[model samples]
Target: MEIDFTNIKVIGFDADDTLWVNETYFREAEEEVGKLLSIYETPNKIDQELFKMEIKNLPTYGYGIKGFVLSMIELAIELSNGSVSNDIISKMLAIGKDMINKPIELLVGVEQVLSTLSKDYKLIVATKGDLLDQERKLENSGLLKYFHHIEVLSEKEEKNYSKLLQHLEIEPSEFLMIGNSLKSDVLPLVNMGSQAIHIPFHTTWQHEEVSHKDGHSSAFKTVKTITDVLNIIY
Candidate 1:
């Protein structure tokens, strides 16, 4: 997939699975909570119960640690005979906070590629997650300087991409979206007439992965790693 970056003034990125590790930490935390909940219910039952809580809370709290904490507390209250203790909730909250505050290990060649691309393109982070969590990770990773615009969206839909392109005041064809998620980062931009590079990450959230059919080849290009991206666009 050969690309000419000279014409691309703005390069948009997905923060979580694209730039650094994210989803895996949340999965770990969820598993830890699941183990505690198993004392009250079966694993499968626990998943169903917790998922129900997630759907109910999404309206009020959105994504990231705050919603996750609320869901866990809700589950604890429901299962623990209405005697949910603050100590258990506090411990889980600390773990969730640590997941964000902890050092991020960039995927192989992520920094090197971004450093190279930033020199020639207008880099922007178009990621959707907890606002404060994403911001803190960016600040802690020390990669904040690479991006001129940091957008923390609640949803990553076609409209979000449209607004981003509009805000940047560039045509869709002139922008390129780069990230690991097909649903959030790639397809939305591709559907909007912008180019997209799909660099597959080993771990992705359940919601982010998109199924690719054989016919839709022109708009989407998948790579095994970030280093592979340099061969195409750089």
Candidate 2:
């Protein structure tokens, strides 16, 4: 479907996989967690249980490496029948710290796209994650100057985006969201009468994946890379 962004005044970008490397580290951490708990269960089972634990803990911990690490620790104890060693717990903590400190690697053409688009649009970041970690990544990304606003949302449901657009004094018809997650970034905005472009990363969190059938009626566009955004908006 051809989307006319001619009326889009404010373009929101999702930070994690859309602009920089993020979900990749979480996959790596999950692998390490799986290996660390191999004695308690098969790697596949461990992974499954860990995902369940994450979902269960989402309400309490929200999202980010700290919450992930806590979930891992809890899973370890439960899988090990409360006999998991402190050493394993310490290793999990280290994994989370390492993830937090990973270098901010921007996706290809991110800066150029931002640089070009910022000239004609009000660019902002509308992402979900721990506020401090998201802020830190933004500071480290060196792309903060290009954005007119930065919002680290606790969630990315329709109401959240509605509130954000309202707070920014933007009309839904005048807004566009670009991101890698259909669940968090695309569908919600499309459902709210805003335009969204999905730029798929090589890897996506299972939680963020959605069936095309689920959003078949929502008007949105999908691109292969961040630079491709220029084609639609320019």
Candidate 3:
């Protein structure tokens, strides 16, 4: 249970789902929005349309509720031939904002494990989401003090991980990225010669899941829960 994390001076973690429950609110909102759209467009067509909009806007707007809200509004307007009322858009935006304001619920035992590991490793939270929203959630959760650094990224690409490693002045081999998504967290870090410990969440956002390629399998490992990583990594 106390194995050393070899050469790992710093440990990076993904915030959403890894530390707390986040996607459920978004999922519920997405379902509600889908229902609203279904009256005008087929469910499949709405899903496709929204996905297209997300792809177009994601690069500019990045992650979290703002981008998603904008995409929903854009799609609704488009579907309505620019006739979608501001009232409907406002209602959707309000729902998204409410989700953003919802309380942050830490996963069971996360605080205890984090407190224990903080004494040994320099912990940094390397999460990708809406910058202000993520910061607020971290602050409200009362877990910010556990981390030495907090990075709010726009995306979870290899370049993002590489940039963080550079900022920390550590080689990839000397750090580990602990997160929920195999696509975002594990593959990128593993490709960069870093280690990754995937703590699978019960549910993942649709956009967050991607097919796993075989190349990086050797460099990555998975566990049942976030706290399990502490036992295996430390």
Best by TM-score: 2
Instruction: Give residue 62's lDDT in candidate 2 (0 to 100).
Output: 96
- Candidate 2 wrong stretches, greater than 4 Å: 215-218
Q: What tens digits encode model 3's per-residue C-alpha lDDT throughout 79-152?
A: 99898877788889888889988988999878987898899889999988888999999999999899999999
Q: TM-score each candidate.
A: 0.90, 0.97, 0.92
Residue-level lDDT of model 2, residues 129-167, one tens digit each, is: 899999999999999999999999989999999999999
Once fitted onto the true fold, the runs of candidate 1 whose alpha carbons sit more than 4 angstroms away are 1-6, 212-216
lDDT scores for all predictions?
0.80, 0.92, 0.84
Clashing pairs in 3: 3-234
Candidates sorted by TM-score, best first? 2, 3, 1
Candidate 3 displacement at residue 17 in angstroms: 1.0
- Name the candidate, 1 or 3, with the larger TM-score value: 3
